[model samples]
Target: MAAGGPPPVLGVDACRGGWVGVLLALGRPSVALFAPRAAELVARAGAAAAALTVVGIDIPVGLSAGGPRQADLLAARELGARRSSVFRTPSRAALEAPTHAEANARSRAAGGEGVSAQAYALRTKVLEVDAWLRDRTAGPRVVEVHPELSYAVLTGAPARHPKRTWAGSEERRAALRAAGIELAGDLGEAGERAGPDDVLDAAVAAWSAARVATGAARSLPDPPEELEDGVLAAIWA
Candidate 1:
């Protein structure tokens, strides 16, 4: 770490190809990389990984078996109109189901609502993080973060446009700039593969990760409920 500077932090977001990660150190984007797997991305952080103080990822972490997680409920309430951006996580049983139909059925049986195809689609990634955390490789530093919430906190309101839209992209970038993190020039191969929204989401996630590392971030459901296995069922932003 630089003299009197904040420890390194990482922000990661899932993309079409794999995952896009942005490493922030000394209050700036030090490097960006795209990895086919989450662990690979952390490894690519190299020396930064050793002292990585926190990692904020745009994915569900701790899961619930009986119903929707309180973190998800609180995050939705916080987003207001943008609440749709926050997908209610399916029960752990649903996530482990064999097929989408079965998953939906399991979710409805547990939570009183069927799982959406969109939310169900995240099962693989959600399970991946769950396993990774269980192994304790990146467990201690990893925290679930919703990019929309990070942006909402940054701009004092939920974003006014959809993330995939041009206007929305600009809105997110502007928020990052206002927070003193600039995304300019060439982003190398990773930036080329990941969508504009993915990159921006990673950047803001990194901003939140930095906040988390420095003890400046807040968690939804403030106290953060813990799963039976000790994983936190909360979203920090």
Candidate 2:
């Protein structure tokens, strides 16, 4: 930890085998960890509870029962052409589907627009984090974030390339470096455990987490709303 710096913050992103966490303490470079479930990630944060002040994850935090969340709608508008990056989170019923087909059906039944294949693929991850949030007694320590939106906030404009591409990763890395965030060590390790883009996303998420801890972050849907389970439904960047 740096002298007189704030407490640590955690930023996470779902990856190939599970979730990738980037822990940022006292404004220094971050440390990365991998977990197969949100529970494992939460446990890691809990273990160092005194050091951890905020958690920013690249996943939806709260869910709607049968419609689109206002936060999702606001995020889409902010992203413009990249609006597609913000998928409409399906209702809780849709998130429990056993298959993509069933997920879409359940989404429609729940009065949502229906699920996308990309969104459907995230159902398990969603449920994992959702379950943890529902059981959380600490009043919203973990908040939702989107890598694209975070990048946009950092660069002062929308990201120009898709994160899956080399150009995109380089662009985001450059932005982070410019912001004084030294992505030290082999970020490739993060890619190896998760995917090529995972490390950068996790790093940016940590940056956002730090912002949240310092009260410099912003949220979609301003005041935020509550999920059926009472979790706040908002996205931060």
lDDT of 2 at 178: 79
Clashing pairs in 1: none
lDDT of 2: 0.80
User: Tens digits of per-residue lDDT for model 1 on 10-94?
Assistant: 8999998689988887744557788888877877774555677788999998888777788999999999999999998888889
> In candidate 2, what are the lDDT values of residues 135-227, reduced to their tens digit?
767633788898889999989998999888989988988988876666666654554687758878887888888788878889998888776
> Each candidate's TM vs. the true structure?
0.93, 0.91
RMSD of each: 2.1, 2.3
Number of the top TM-score candidate:
1
The runs of at least 3 residues in candidate 1 whose Cα sits more than 4 Å from the true structure, single-residue gaps closed, are: 1-5, 27-29, 48-50, 137-140
Looking at candidate 2, what is the lDDT of residue 52? Answer: 75
Q: What's the lDDT for all of these models?
A: 0.84, 0.80
